[model samples]
Target: MLDNIEADFPEYAPRRPGAPKALDGIRVVDFSHFIAGPFATMILADMGAEVIKIEAPGPGDDLRRYPPVHPDLKHGAPFVWTNRNKRSVALDLKMPEGVAVARDLIATADVVVENFSTGVMERFGLDYEACRKIRPDIIYCSVSAYGREGAFADRLGFDPIAQVESGFVSMNGYADREGVRALSPVMDISTAMMACNAILGALVARERSGLGQAIEVSLFDSAVLMTGYATMQHLFSGANPQRHGNTSPDTCPSGVFRAQDCTFYINCGNDKIFQRLMAQVIDRADLAEAEIYATGPDRIRRRDELFAILGEAFARQPWSYWQARMRVAGVPCGQVRTVGEAIRSPEARERGIVTRIPHEKLGWIPNVTLPIRYSGTPIVDPVAAPAVGQHTESVLRELLGYDDSRLGRLASAGVFGADAARRPRQDAKV
Candidate 1:
């Protein structure tokens, strides 16, 4: 797979001046795997940073083995999706030469990202203290299950664990059954976003103070934030938030309901929306003006009766009929859609959210462009994810200016395996 790893992306050329890129000369040493840290670095790479991903020898990042693997790619879809525009350097930190080389890379790096368990970086001599000694003003970010200083820092964690422990899972699903965890790793992904924001903030501060600092983002902390303002509400009311399934606990008529054909959701978040829904969509002006349902709180108090009345009206028509009526009534509503359906919807196409990009081997593959849009200095053209140690020799030759003989000695000692001896090609562009 490493031997056949390829790229055929269009060469990026700015169409206008002053588009040097947001992180034109920034260098990031990425020592992360799986979701969080790798994703954070990928965002930086998308902004034109040079990201060097240091992976363990052998199969490298575990995300490479995830299911739904890309037929023509070395890593699976998740890995490829998050790791594009980064260089892969297979290194065995267990070996002294590998550790020495990693330290050398960190010595000149402007930023470093790691998501290993607590103390793992320290064991490899790549911790914040060691990195600071090499480059005193280097931005270093650490991602973990819990933070580094907490009592639970030693305990391992993942997205699901964070979700359950942070009250996220408790607030989901129906009150009757067990709350289900989100199938996707929401906590890990959101934590990565937080980490990226922190890294950007650090970069901005470095420009002002000429000093870099350490940043810590964890799945646990981010998961709690994902719980929204439920914690604050609970503290004030001293009441636990009940699981509402598809409905909003604080809003009336905001739940899933089946039309004659398919299921749909209605969100009458305010009294005006509820009145519009009742008068225009359901043709029941009496309900809209009734004292029992005139206000949001009153509607919530009599939700059962209101839902029964709306359900009967909605059941008389198909989802499309109710959708159109709600749209004209100024009521927020949507048809329930599967993941695949949502991706292929007309709105998604109109917005260009889902697109097919040129792939070297497959010819074209679907890519999801991020929601972020910049009027200037747009994201760099993307490249396919790299194989294990795909850029190892090139990185050494270019960044450290190591000749073939030095690379051979390192490979001879199992610093990056015998594959490191492969000739570096000019086409190995991140």
Candidate 2:
């Protein structure tokens, strides 16, 4: 078992103090909640941005109380996963004092990220214009389900809705059934990536312009972008793609098939690869020379026949056998592992994708490291996700120079209430 990084890698400063990370020293005020917005900001935080997440005064982010709450963290697993490396400050933005404090924070921030419905920020007086007034070089990132303008601007949209509206759902699954939404939040994750990309681009542009810009990203746009080849086919050939289950219309023998012990996917994308796969894995040199399967189109045309032959061959051996043989032949192949399997697999462990970190309360809890790698400045080892307003007093003192009396006054005024109180030291209970 791997020990906590802080203990094991004592000399590792992950990123050197003077050395700049990809977004080192950048300040971000994150107002987004739930997955998409938080996910994007999480990436920024991992890259060394100082992200301060403002949450509601009471329960804070909804995910805090979401089900599967960890006994030690008292928050959902998903929430902890997305919010590490961020400072949590609970505030009732509805209050005048809270709003004033927020303005002060924004005044010193390089970016403001929010995903409230189209004009909610404007109504709250935290819109781009307001931020620009305080800090001329502020990057205001507004994430929405649809967009800032147009008919659906105010309409509610989620990952599934984006998939349906953008024609992405139509390209999934088999034709026998109505195309289904992906089990995972594909659109949300993609939108997060796009939003991060946009922020990075704006940061680069700002370096030269000495000004800031308002950035917009929508779930619909990300969904449409994800339909790369599907959109291309429709645009160039006037063809509507059908849902082909576990097989590709463009490439035959490129999907899952059953082995004696398990199932696996094999991609014989082109004729040359198919020939190699046949000769190497199937031990069928004669099959490669067969006229009917000489080219991609020909193999695609005879997909059923080809599938029948390949299927029988694959079923003769177990998944591990084929996985090794196919990989050795330089073909792209892998076993269809479950989520649990994938997480614990040797490849994932070796890459340090999943790691154990010592949480204040949990002692040892698992965290997934940021996937991006930079030679000069890698992500800093994450601090444990905070309890509600865990850094309230410290942040107030350090950032705004608030003394004990001022903090007490604010607390008494309900700016910071019961939930903001320091948690009593406790043993691991999760």
Candidate 3:
């Protein structure tokens, strides 16, 4: 397993020791789980917001139990990937005391994020209107399958469902077979990014007007947007996109090809790039200057023939040989790599995209940092995702000023579930 790998991997370090972070002084009460909501809040947490993740008392977030669980961490790999730089607080929202405690936290928070079904928050009295009563300037964001007030709001949806419903699946895979959904949770991830962007915009607006507003991001809506310019093209041409496998419908000679030693992808986005690929990289000026392949449309009309010729030429050399020639010719190309290969590639290492971070029990664990860079304000140094309810006592003590006696009373009332509330207070930390 990657977690067990021992090597001289670089350790994560603070970019600016004493400098302020972009979202410093911000506090977010995150009632989200799984990918979309948690990922959005994780981005906020990465930017230095104090994100308090509110999970259910017993099982907590479902992602915590996802496959490939780490023994020492007691959480799955996916949970660790998205929940870093945040505090966990387990609360039984079914109990009134738990709801009261949640309201108390909201009063002290600048933002609230949730991904529950339509009426779940309202049932717990944590909806936007209710939260606004607690903190009028709160930036409340909701992530759902559909619009919160729409007819389809009650419909349950996940990444694959959204992909199919939004026409994303229809535009992918090979033309000869049924369209295939992307294995990755592209819809969920893109929805998270949209939610984060919306929240950031809301924060900026709040700073200007001293007012906060409700923000909604839906997986279905985000999935539709993820279809890219294809939607616009469909509107303009009155036609839906057809699956073309690795090859592009708009460009010729833009797809997967095999070199002598490896497979690679090349994208000739325009005529000039195609010209460069044939004339300079492959040393085929005849093909480059041929009238049959002069323009994008012309080449696209003869895509199969061009691809066959290019394939033969690429197969004559190893990836390194073709890669070097393509680099000199200024052609855009890359080797098709697996996830493991890409993560450990020279590019990933040189950019410091992956590193090891200290873990209380595991010594160190792999960490993937965000791609953002700022000259003035840098991202926060990542902290491992907390154990279940890891900061319940400390957060209650510091934020709500609850003493041991009060905590004991709440625990006795079943506010923090069976095991969590019974745990020794000293075991929980901030």
Candidate 4:
């Protein structure tokens, strides 16, 4: 078995010289895959929780296979995006020994996160009920397409389905074409945020009550919220929302516009912003003074004429010129940049939104940190995402207090994987 984990995960740096992280003492056993559950646990990891990701001996999380793949890393960009600062423990859960080792980890974990299909955990004998028996105060979280019970619990779901079912897709796209699901996994992203908040709340409650509870966050439920007030308006007005394309149904002069050289977006949320845009940015003082465009309601009533005028004016200038004018005028506007441009923008680099971090084999790779800022409990400096089963020997020996003999026994039983056979046998517990 692998005795030295440093060879497996040279990028796995667990600690740095810092003040203190909010979750310094917390330990999380992450069984989540893809986006939501992993995302939630990644937030916790950012807060300094020790996240132990249990992956199967072979392929590991499916996200590791997503593109654009790194040639040397084996895992892809999507996997690295969320799985950073986590330690990977390879275990073949199909084997009884694997299940036993998983239970051992859960017994010591403060939080357990899973996004497997309903009843899969139960079948593995690692369900919340089974886990709670090992550690009664364990905060268990299950992320799913739907709730774990009821009529639709068995149904599998992805971000697109959630958007469709929750009315999110219906609210997007132009009214003429069929409604389109957002290219981004907005539902999944929102669900991750919800699950993160729920887990944090559970942790707070546990502090006072010394008790743990289970949390369930579903993509369908969060996707509805992602639709914003459309659901509420439907209840009140008893009418379904029609897709409005890039334009907002509630606000005028709030959509994409083309400049001489580039596309840009503008949002005149209220009459005041509209006035500023006309008077300062576009220098249309007469239009700013017009009674028909003085209020938000009036502007909405005449959005077509207003858009036509604005489009003509914007077309005369390049994006940079309009952006500078809008900045001075306090108009909410930005260039409609591609993903690569957005990440490499000067502002993003200055703010450390996207920066380079050292990797084991790759030397350096781009890293995107969480957006949150804290004055006291600062986030930990991130480490690169772990390789599958990279920390198996270390975690088994250090965290689980298993010695060389035990690890060897588990390895011999085909618990770890085919790769496990290559790891040198540990002489003794670390």
Local error of candidate 4 at residue 79 (angstroms): 0.7
Candidate 1 scores a C-alpha RMSD against the true structure in Å of 3.7
Residue range 1-430, candidate 4, lDDT tens digits: 1123333223323344668899999999999999999988999999989999999888999999999777778889889999988998888888888999999999889999999999999999998899999999999999999899999999999999999999988888999998998998888789999999999999999999999999999999999898899889999999999988889888988999999999999999998898899999989999999998988788888989999999999999999999999999999998899986886677776666765567667666666889988778878888888888888888877888998789888887778887566566432111
What lDDT does the true structure give each of the candidates? 0.85, 0.82, 0.91, 0.87
TM-scores for all candidates: the values are 0.93, 0.93, 0.98, 0.93
Candidate 1 lDDT, tens digit per residue, 170-198?
A: 99989999988999899988999999999
Please give the lDDT score at residue 41 for candidate 3.
96
* lDDT tens per residue, model 2, 1-430: 2334444322223456666677778999999988889999999988989888898877888878766787656788778878888888878888788888789889889989999888888877899999999999999998999899898899888888898888988888889899988878899899999999999999999999998999999999899998887898899999888999889988877888899998888888888889888999899999988988898888889988888898999999888888888888888888899987897788887777776666665566677887787888878767766777766666767788887777777777777655344433121211
* Model 1 whole-model lDDT (C-alpha atoms): 0.85
Better of 1 and 3 by TM-score: 3
Q: Highest lDDT, which number? A: 3
- Where model 4 places Cα greater than 4 Å from the true spot, the runs are 1-16, 422-430
RMSD to truth, every model: 3.7, 3.7, 1.2, 4.8
Runs with alpha carbons beyond 4 Å of true place in candidate 2: 1-20, 418-430
Candidate 3 weakest lDDT stretch, 10 residues: 421-430
Which portions of model 3 show Cα errors greater than 4 Å?
Answer: 427-430
Assess candidate 3 and give its lDDT: 0.91
lDDT of 3 by residue, 1-430 (tens): 5644447468776676788889999999999999999999999999989999999887889999997998777799999989999998889999889999999999999999999989999999999999999999999999999989968999888999999999999999999999999999999999999999999999999999999999999999999999999999999999999999999999888999999999999999998998999999999999899999999899888988988998888889999999999999989999999998998889998988988987878878888888888788888888888888888888888889998899999988878779855666554443
